[model samples]
Structure formats: structure tokens, C-alpha cells
Target: MAKFPLSDLRFYAVDTNVLIHDPNALFKFEEHRVVIPMVVLEELDKLKVGTTALAADARQAVRTLDSLLGAATPAEIMSGVAIIRAGGQALGTISILMPAQQSNLGLQPNSNDNLIINDLLVLKQSTEVADVVLVTKDINMRLKARGAGLSSEDYHNDQLISDMDSLATGYHHVVGSFWEQIEAIEPQRVSGDGYHQMNSATLQAILERKLYVNQFVYDDKEFVCRIYKEVGGLVTIELLNTALLMRQKAWGLAPRDLFQGMAMWLLFDPEIDLVALNGPAGSGKTILALACALEQTMESKDYRRIIATRSTRGLDEEIGFLPGTEAEKMQPWLGAFTDNLEALHAEDFDPGSSADYIGAKVPLQFKSLNFIRGRSFQQAFLIVDEAQNLTPHQIKTIVTRAGEGTKVVCLGNLAQIDTPYLSATSSGLTYMSERFKGFQHGGSISLQGVARSRLAAFAEAHL
Candidate 1:
């Protein structure tokens, strides 16, 4: 762990989500005098009234404040901790600045983000007597804070994996005589620490050779064994015959959507028991996974059912009382699922049957990270979407749910978006990629291209 220069700091202005990520943040900064910039408290208050994960976090922050202030006014500065009601006047180590009287300064209209920025500015001006650091997880906000001459930093609550190469160490790259030698051995079942690391060409070769279990092959002089093991087992997707051809046609594509093809190959591979997909927005992570599920369920009948799930990290505020059964409550968060289904159905799939299977073919299940406890899945093609929002702990919860004959596909964009405490490198998707890199059944591919639209790709790059 890196040591922070905490001894010299007198005031630390904490961002709302930082506290929400870990409620014990108050005690984490124990010895140092901390300031909950009034604006942050107001933001927490607004969050507390909602039903989303943020609301739950906000309520926790309020409870912590109540413990400190003992029913005092919301803006009261008690003890060394000052709870400034955002926009209220208070003497503290930081001042909350309102938006400068200008509309063209890139401030979004009626955005609370603007208020947070203004508050940070005020706190920066007021803290002239001490060193002040504005902490936030937002990249744009960090950029803006730097532009104003304020010392700023990412919250560091969630970070990406440090070693990128570690995500591919499990699969052996075969060439020359070794490749031919393995082809000759023709193992019936092949297992490695990370099987997903193998390219589609290698997988296809294994499938064509009809190799059985206990077969051994050599990569050069290094001997590799064919041990049958299941990690995240094969994901059977039912897709249109065209979709299957599209993937088979894209064999060995090395660019943005390569992961899509890779995932498709894994779904078709009988040897691979587990596969993981990690990428950013417009990377075709979800689309490919959905297509694979469709193909397997409708065509091969390889798996009993396709199970799709996403962590409801940021569903909405006041979601607990949304007035509906489980399916109805899930409508809003499952919009992405619906959109992906609609696109797949457009490829000449029967819409009537597709609707019937929307909740049945690839049953989209809305499960929070907290609800994954005490569950086991078997013989299922499982797809975990939006995996970037999950923490390492949360990822373990979902992955461990895999029972016999279950292949889990974790899909998410490392960049473009994340949850409050997660980032591109530190998210569960990256964690799994790195941790399971050496496993024979586990595979990971980073998606880079935007297939949604030309304008979407342009916006992702330029805007």
C-alpha cells in the first residue's frame, strides 16, 4: 500500500460517493480532521430520499452524521467535523462556491454536478490557510478542478488491474512444430489454467481432431496435458443462423469486436467451461453474449436455459416502491436487455416467440450484489452484464454461483462508465480477467470498436 502524506493535512473534503462506497470512511480518516463540504451533505440528503443504491448509501451517511452531531441542525459544525448544509454559510476549512454567473463556461443546465463544482471552488478559496484536496471519481470533474488551480485527485476507491499482460498468461501460444505436435496428439479433452486464452483457431483444431480426455501434447518441448476441467462452463446461445455465420466469418479478427468473435467461439467450444468478456461501451460485449445465448438455446439445446443478470448498482431512486411484481420492478433497469433483444430479433427472428422468450429464452434477471448469496446455478448459460460496476467481492459472489455445467460470461465496458467506487482497472471484470488468466477454461478479450453507429463511434472519440 502507498503511504499518504496524512500527517500534514488538516482538512479533507470527501466526495459523497467516496463515503457511500465505504461507510466507514469517517473512521478511515480517523486521526485527520475531515470536512464534509456542505454541498456533499446536501447531495447525500437528496440521495437518502431515493431507493437506489446511492440512496441506501446516503441514508448510511446521514446515520453517521446523526451519531456525530446528535440532532443538531443539518448545517451545524460540531466537534472537528463540520457538516455544511450545501449553500449554507459556515466557517470551515472549505467553502462551497456557487456557479459563477456565466452560462457558457461548460456548466450543464440544472445539474447538481455544477453545484458540487461550485461548492468545491468555495471550499478551495476558504481553505487558503491549509492544504486542500478535492477528491472525486469523475474524470471531467477532476479536469475542471485542475483547471481552477485546485489540487484534485480521483477517489481511488476502485482502480483498474495493474498488469495488463497478466490477463493472458494461462493460454499457451503455440507455433511451429509445437502446434503440429498438439494437432497430432489430438487430445479428447484439454484443460489448462486458463483455456479462454487459446485463440479460436486452436479451439477449432481441438474440436475437429475429436481428441478425448487424458491426452497430452507438447508446445515445443514443454508438455501440456488435456485435463477436463470446468471453470465458467460453455455458454449456449440461441441465435439466428445468420448470427452464427457472422461470428464464424469473423474468425481471427484482431480489432475492436474481436472479443465478440472470441466469445462466440467459446460458446461453440465444448471444452471451454467458463468464459469472461471485458470491454468498454460500444464494444459489442453484451450484443455478442446475447447472440450466443440465442444461438445455443434455440438451435443446439446444449444448455437448459440462458440466464442473464446485471448488478443494479445504480438503477434509480425510490425503486423499492415502483409498484409492480419482480418483473415490473425490473423494467427500468432491464431496458438495456430489452434493447439488445430487440436488435437480435430484428435479424429475422420471430418477434412473437422472442417476446415470449424475453423472460424465458434468455431470462433477464435483476439481482443486486447483495442478493446473490446462497444461490447455485447448474447447466445454465449465464451472462453477467455491466460487470464494470461490480467490486471484486461482488464479482466473486456472482462467479461462485456457477454450479455444474454452467458457463458464466461476465460482460462490461472497463471505460466509458462505472459505479461509484469502481474504475476501468479496478472493476471486477478486470479482476476476473487477471485472476483467471491462467485458467484453461477462463478467457478474456478487450473490445475496442463501436458497432452501434458511425455517429456513436465519432461521439465516443471526439465528444
Candidate 2:
């Protein structure tokens, strides 16, 4: 149904944010024609002046445009150039829409949105593309385009899942009995490593095709199993020690529920390279990640340091202008980690001092995403909070920086995404989680319930 929104449009005029969100968006339309307004190029040029991630994206978009349109003459440019991928597959055609004569959109040119709407209006008048669509990430821009008698749509090509509820919660929760499908078990490995071989083709029918590797399956009767391997019709499930999982501790923290337990299992597992935690506002995502990070870095000595970061609107443009050292500027955005640190040490006589001491003791560094490009980290525990605000490209840029022996944990509340361009289904957290669902070294869990406070939980439910 998500794919139903985007009918293969013959002609599409893309907005600047769409290109920024995915720099290679021009070539993704698959044999269709893509139109880039001259004003959009000008907007990208202005955004290219900063060192932020936005600036990087703008520069990349401009570079892609140049690479495609550089050798073309005015006549050929007026027509269109074939869009080719880096893998040498030719798909669509891209052309620039120049400034048109006075348009009848009746909107002032005080904003870029108005200019694009006016340009599209003029283009529709001159050309037979009366159904030409404006692809954008702005809701108000789409509304304005409609008011101007132009068709507009959201950039939904990268939205993998149509519905948010269909997205996996990193586990399969069954009602009555799920073990009835199991026919045989290997007693040797079952006693030694908790491994059990079963026919998952039968289980897939039972669960309706939600099963994947590294996903936990549990029933109401206290049965818990984690799928580590899936070979054709046969599936390998490692029965989990529920008592040990419930009693799992990182630093001084414990899982509030089985879902949180599954999340922490992925966090502490030496095999999992990426762990994603999705939940509501107070579901202990940050606290759990912080606890595991501390346990691994401080006690286990598995990692060298901890890098904390997040993505928020206006953070890229304004972080550099803030007064203070890099750490001081990042402290405001990273206050959640420190706040959770206080939570971890709340039972101490002096929780404030304990948090401070732990902060000083652990090699925890709060860094901004602005300067994270092109840098690599080895033996590091990278925690990316507010991951739902990230675009698919932006998250890829961050996750690719992990060197060998590094683990990344992404935490986000899809219910509270503050970015204008992202929704629960289109978030980078959702994108990465969907893309990495079957990765052997990756796991994700949706932490249920609100663990903040009675008032917070009440507000989460009623508000």
C-alpha cells in the first residue's frame, strides 16, 4: 500500500529536501523524467556553505547534478539527460527547469516554496504535463502546490514499509502455544548450547511470515527461543534461559520486561554489531544502552571508548554557532545520557557525584554528528540517539564509520519524531531496522511500556 502512493509518474519535479535526504534520488525514478528547478539548485548552493551534514548532502546533490549535466549543451539540457547509476545501469532522464515568465500562482517570491510552486504553475501552462507532480518533504508546500492547481506528493520512494504497525518489534509474541510445530530437537547441542533444530516452514505459516534471524520468539506460557540460523526449510532456535535473561545486569541496571531483556541481550552480545531500540518516550532505551556501554567499556574491557551523538532539526546549522568547547556544546543535546547516568546511580548516597565520577572514569565522549563525516572509530561503542530524525542517507553515513571491533546502538522513539520530513514508516531507524532485520550481527527490539514515572507514563497514555 505504501508503494501504491507513488504511481510511476512520467514527469516529476523534485524538491531540495528530497535530494538532500537522498542525494542519488534523481536516478531512482526508473525510466521516468526528473525535473530540477533552477531555484532548487540555487537553494542547494546556499546550503553548501556549511560544515554540517546538511551542507554535505547539498554539495553531494550538486555534484551529482553536475556529473549528469556538465557536458550537455543548452539544447540537450533543455531536453533531458539519461540518468545512470554508479553501477552503470541507465534508468531515468534528468533535466533542469529554468525560470519561466511571470507565473500566475499569485504567491510572493519571498520563499523558495512559493518560487517552486510558481515555476511548476508556469511549466504546467506551457507543457502538456498537466499532471506533472511536485515531489517534496514539506506538507505545507504540498498544500500550497494544490492551492496553485498543481499536483504534489511526498517523496515516498524510500519508504519501505507501508504501515508502521507492520514493522517488526524484533520479536514474535504468541498468545497460547507456539512449540506445537516443533517435531524434533538435537539433545546434544540442546543441552550444551541450547540449540534446537525445527521445521520453520511450518512455523512461518503459524506466524504468517514475520520470523527472521536473531529475532526472539516467546509465548504466554513462558517459552522463549531466539533464532540464530535459518537454512531453507530448517530453522535453528537457541532456547533462552529466561531466568538469566530477566536477571541480566549491565552496570547497575536491569530489564523491566522481556522485551527490554531481548534488547539488552543484543546489546551485550559480542556477535551483534548493531542493536536498534525503538519505543515510547520513557521506555528506557537510552538508560539501557548507557548501562550496557558502561559495562562493556568499564568492566568487560571489550571497547576502548564511548561516542554519544544524536540528530535533531536545526542542530547541524546551529551547533557550530553555539558558545563553548565541542563537548560543552554537545552536552546540551547529550543531556539524556547524563540524565540516564543519574538514573543508573540513583540509589547511591550521592547520585550526582556518582554520575560525575562515572563520566570522568569512563572514556565517554559526546560528539556532534556535524564532524562525524569521514572519521573512523575502532574498538568503540557508538550510541546514536534520536535516530528516527535521521534520513536513510544520514544514518548510513554514520553507521559506515564504524571500524572493526566496534558496535553501534541506535535508539529512537518513532512516536515522537520532531523532524518535518520523517514519519514513523520513513524514519532511518525504521529503514535500517527493516534493511538489517535478517543480518546475523544485528538485532532490534521495541521496548514496551513507559518506565519513566507514574506521571510520565500517564501522560504517555492519556496525552
Candidate 3:
């Protein structure tokens, strides 16, 4: 946990992702002297001209900045907000440090990241009067800033829940199972207090094993309620089957494997028309979803098509317009989907003609979330990757687009990262889990382990 001396900062360089994460970042840092690096503004400009959610946010930020500073000079203060235009904006009561040509730092062409570093270098060289810090989401950028003798820190807007156990306790509970032993107790009569008391895994074990309903399992000489069911319902059946198939196909799996059984369980619920999976990096959420999708599409015609999509959060800091068709524009973001498909095909399907088989049997369709609006899907299996980066409204739009018989699965690692304002608890994943709880048809599961490798698991746990 890195701590910052908030009162000591004189100048803060805002990164583009920081702005994209929260358009109101400017207002949030009202008392601080903020500087939108010339490169960052340029990156935001490119996003403002687009149709994606990030672009819309960038446009809003630009509007807010314009309103705050309507042509003021350096260090001129109005309404307690100081403004400076380096890259483009021509307004405000802040000092704009335009670096001389010699301070360019010779950044690579078309690299928004290099440009940002160059801008930071210029700010460091030009601003000899004010204390400056570089704020960004990119770890590499932060490292580069440090290397250049400038202070740097990650944007802290997306963190809503600091303690995982505290957040988990909100819905988790432990209680005695007296009601289960009582004959003729209606299922609907079971109170939420009883349900919330048990960890999902324990409840699931009781239900699957067909243990005596009212039998007391001694932990500390205390009786706990046993809520279990013998016959698995439709949703349970889908989840169990999918989990088993995924585990069988993927070798070297374990109980806590993030992308093996748990990922499948999270994504494949017959009752949940929409599902979301969030985890950190190397969790295998995407791989598991892709594997389950491939299994269903190949083994059974459960869905007409496998539609995979994601929102480009503008991780790259470039300003040039995207060239070519939608497919070309989407190539960068869809690389994960492609990689998962290739891995699955390499492991399960025949290698010599796997491409032909993928083309024929898989029929995986890739699209950006922006193009998903206004189209209703019927009998389709939809997977929304990187869902943590989306806003509640954007998530609502995606979920409502599901037509009859459409099952939508959302997968992302909350701890690994996301856009600003969306935290692990407040993200769409958490929202869906709370909203859909207790529906016999809907289910939610959180994956904890790294399934990729021992090193990956160690890194996830320690790094």
C-alpha cells in the first residue's frame, strides 16, 4: 500500500486511462494543481472522436475542462480550479509548461506511451518551480517516470473494497440447520439469514451428497444448518456438466483452478440469462469461457453462434485514427479470444486440420461491445470479456440485448484491473451476483486459484 502526501503535491500529470476510468477525475482532485500531459490530452482527443464508451467519456472530460477554464493565463485561479493547456486546450489560470525541442526525449513514432514519457520528461525539465508527480494506470509508465527522476503512482479510483474478507462477509454466514430437519418445511420459507450463513461450497456439498437434512456437523461442538438438495436442477446441471467437461479437457487441473471448473461453473447456468466472472490476471476466466463455449458448440447445437466481444478501454495512448474495417480495428482487443481458441483447438481438436474444424464447428463471431447495441440475440451463447471495464449502464445495455434463449457470460479479473469508478464490489459482476441471488435458475461463483502454472499461481498469490 503506497501512501501519498496529498497536501504536498503542486503539479500532477494525469494519464489518459485515468481520465477514461473516471471522466470526473478533474473534479475529484479539485484542490490539487492538475496537469493533463500534452500527450494525454492528445490521446483523449483521439478517443473523443470515436463511438466507444471510452471515447464518450473522453468527450465529456474535454467539455468539463473547457467549461472550467475559458481562456485564462498562467497561475490565474477561478472558482478554486487552475487550468493549463499544453497539447491543445487554450484556457485556464494554470501554468502551461511547453518544453523546448531539445527536451523531446526522442520517443518512438506512433507510441502514445513513449510520448507520455517524453511529455513527463518535458514537464520535469520545464517545471523547476513546482513539485510534480506522474499519475497513470500503466505500471511500465510509472517505472519510466521513476527512472526519469519523477514521482509516479497508480490511479486509485477503482478500489472500492479494501478488505476482501470484509466484502465476502456481507453475504456469507454460518447457522444451525434446524429448519432442514423439520418435516414439511417449504423451500421458499427458508430465510436469507440461513442461506447467507454458509459458504457456497459447503451448501453445495450438502445438496450434492444427499446427507441427512438435519444432521449436526460438529465444528466447535455447535450444530450448523444443513441445506442440501439431492436432485440437481436445470441450472445446476448445466454448471456441473460444463465444469466436468472443462476439467476433463484441460489437463493438470486442481480444486482451486481459476479457469477450470469454477470458471465453467460461473459461466454456464441455464437459469442465468446473464453471468459475470471477475478475477485478477492469470485467472483463466477467458480461457475457461472459451473452452466451455467450444465444447457446447462442437458437442451440441445448444446455440446458433458463439459471439465473443469486449470494450476497448483505450489502454494504448496513441492519437492516430484507426484504419481499415471493423475487423481490423477490433483485431487488437480480440487477440485474447483468438489466443484462447487456438489453445483449445491445439489441445483438444486435431492439429493438422484444426483451422478447418474451427471454421466449421466453432463458428466463433467476434465484435466490439459498441456494435452490440440494437441487436437481439436468440439461441446464442454470448461471452463478454473484460466486463470489469464497463459501467453499470453499459452492462445494462449488454444484458438487455439478450433475446429469448440467449445465455450471456461475462468474464474479467477484478483484482487484475479495470476502468476507474468500477471496483470489484461495485462492478457489474458484483451487481449481478447480488441482484440474481436465490433465483433457482441463476448461480454465481468466484474463482480463486491460478490454473495456468505453478509460477502463475505463486505470482497471483504473492505478487
List the candidate 3 regions with Cα displacement exceeding 4 Å. Answer: 1-50, 54-163, 166-266, 315-323, 348-352
RMSD of 3: 10.8
| Alpha-carbon lDDT of model 2 | 0.86
Give Cα distance to truth, residue 72, candidate 2, Å: 0.8
* 31-90 per-residue lDDT for model 1 (tens digits): 445666666777777777643545555677678766656645434342353434336533
- Model 3 has how many clashing residue pairs? 10
Superposed model 1: Cα runs more than 4 Å off: 1-10, 21-34, 60-130, 139-149, 161-274, 279-284, 291-305, 310-381, 389-407, 418-423, 426-428, 431-443, 447-463
**On TM-score, who's better, 1 or 3?**
1
lDDT of each: 0.57, 0.86, 0.57
Total clashing pairs for each candidate: 48, 0, 10
lDDT of 3 by residue, 310-429 (tens): 755563223235676666666777888877666655755475477576766667787667667668988888988777766544677688888988888877766744454456655655
Specify the highest-lDDT model's number. Answer: 2
TM-score (all chains, Cα) for each model: 0.53, 0.94, 0.52
